[model samples]
Target: MMMRSSPFWPLFSQGIRHRVLPRSSLLTPRRTVKTLPSFSLENKTCVVTGSARGLGKEFLTAFALSGARGACIDLSQKDCEASIASIASQVQNAYPDDPVPELRAYECNATIESDVKSTWAKVVEDFGKVDVLVTAAGIVDNVEAENYEYARWRKMLDINIEQGHFVLAEEGREMLTWHNIQGSIILIASMSATICVRPQKQAAYNTSKGAVQMLAKSLATEWGPRGIRVNSLSPGYMKTDLIKGLLENEGKELVGSWERDIPMGRMAEPHELRGTIVWMASKFPTKPVNPA
Candidate 1:
């Protein structure tokens, strides 16, 4: 004969069900959802190296439009001043009712460690604290490896690695630490770091950018625990002043080849990266997400 079920069997089943399923009040409604964090950079101070022109200026302009006080660092004070003025004018025109964030020009040769340190000191003194840094100061050369000179290669690494990226990152880290601020650092790497671009023999340039990507990873590991975010932004071919001469003259055919290689059939415009720059500078990501 089958044994009779315990009288408490229904209560035991109900208890198990109660433990497994959340209470009605504890469950979130289907319509309720987490909202995206604001990408606004209001009241934040930003520093952009190589901000006089090209991709650097584009990043700076994006920061300015997002309501960040900007420090435009370049090799030429005159150029930085001019660029900042132009950015300010555009920002004013775009937001007629809103106050234009303060933008300052600081001349700093990024390839020189002393200059970078001194300039960073000034930036900290002026801005009180730096919340974001974008190292866009770098050089690219297309010399065939077979005939590449030692001096040229050394210069390429010096500008793109030693002083350009590492030194600036170190200084920025110090400033952030001193101010007890958890900040963002964006290293402007290149797609060439991972892919070999055709029609260009830039062994030195490629090596430098590869190092940059690695540097970002290394720094992220070291600084993440310190609440500092380090990431690399590897943009592909872009229509910027760095390649204006090449695109306009001898490298016209080269540009065509680059465009064909690109899935979109054209190089990117500097302004096209504006939204990306702002988002990266914002607190949304909160963690490092290096993009190649």
Candidate 2:
């Protein structure tokens, strides 16, 4: 048999071939392997918006349980303190031996771009760097389209779509790129983006969520090559204070109506979304999940 050089032989020991791979080729291409990354948030720093209550507060607890330092960014300082305390208590109860992950609260109005930027800067200053960003600040306007005023519609878009979602994505991308950190950004969208809710009309809220879903998809395409992942988690109705008033007014009838529509037969709890949130923020190999 005659001897011939094989292309794959480059993978062999350099001592044998007395050859070195080009720096670009060595660093650019990664081997494709099937292995799940550890779903641990140990020592990671996360910045979460709208952490005062509801799903945002639940995320804070999840972060604490996963051993992540967190910055709870909400509109009210008092509310943020309450959220931080809640997370701390959960960590103490769950992992008594382990030191509770640091949790700080920042009063930030996400609707203001300057406030968002400053709050993120403060988070970076305190935590060294942010490993994950969660945009969870939002509001729902369940008013009839006919009665919806121009100001209300604009305000809804301003807060729900632009400040709460777009601004966070922009700032997070900047931070990730600057730090050269392969981080994840999770935007909170809603199932209403895909399906209109019955018995109530929230056109502004639905439209805002739909826009968020699209924004996340667009950013995923733009940022995937840069090692930063952007994903939008669109959750169904959840049992949280955000919708408590409406739930109380409608009582069991509306509850039953929504439950019948969903295969789960019930609304999700705030804690129910924690696992998915952790997975998204983990080192797992996850592609950008638009409307996830």
Candidate 3:
């Protein structure tokens, strides 16, 4: 399989969309988003795909801390349940009386329309409207570009690109008839979408994210009319199992020393990505409005 190269981006940004989208196109009389008010996630329900571990786990943590009733969905069903159990147990240990997040786990394969539909049916049955949708479900392989496995490469496209589009499309359909409420959708991309990965075979993985970047903006345009905000959150390399072996090779010289190359002087921590997810996912405020 021949893999196409990816370009750097803010795929959420439509060249001509400052007018229709929920987002402000530029600095104006109103405060910039940077200076905008922070909203609470208390009692709001959120769903995170691929929430069993890694970036998904970080998203779980962020939503939990922000007071969302979070549901962690993953193809690895058992592992997903274990993660929820562990997090719930931790909160029980740390804060006995406070309201812990109403967290649930569901086994879902985003690539399968049946799974996406059924899982979402259950999720909505449990928690009414899906104000936020975060699709982190993806897989990676380590085959050389020239010798990438045909089967693995195709499967990668199924999970990474198709699954995202399928889930987003499904969610958009549901949100359309929703009670005029606002919604947010976020897809996770990678730095590989910008820089060409090297020294290993990740052509499939890189290509998937590259495709996802554009899919997000197209959705933003279509769904913006319905008060939906769709965006992509791209991450730099992080210390996750996908790249653990590649980084941990005895003398790779990149493993524990990657901070040397990062402009911030450090490999990303699990907590680092959470802030962005939480900010974008939970956009509603919880407080009494002050009348001027």
What is the per-residue lDDT of model 3 for residues 1-292, given as tens digits with 9 covering 90 to 100?
Answer: 1111111121222231111111122211221124234555656677788878878877877776665667788876567767776666665565555546667677777787877877776677546777778888887777777887788789999999988877887788788875555777888887777667555558888899888777877777777767888888888777665556556553456543545557777677777776777777756422111110
Candidate 3, position 11, lDDT: 26
Model 1 agreement with the true structure over 12-100: per-residue lDDT tens digits: 33222101111123212222113344687767888888889999999999988777788888877668877887887888787766566
In model 3, which residue pairs have backbone atoms overlapping below 3 Å? 143-201
Per-residue CA lDDT of model 2 for 70-130, tens digit only, reads 7787877667877777777777787666566667777777787777766665566556788
Report lDDT per candidate: 0.76, 0.74, 0.67
How many clashing pairs per prediction, in order?
Answer: 0, 0, 1
Runs with alpha carbons beyond 4 Å of true place in candidate 1? 1-37, 169-172
Q: How close is candidate 2 to the true structure, as a TM-score?
A: 0.84
Ranking by lDDT: 1, 2, 3
- Which candidate has the highest TM-score of all? 1
Which residue pairs does candidate 1 place in steric collision?
Answer: none
What's the TM-score of every candidate structure?
Answer: 0.85, 0.84, 0.79
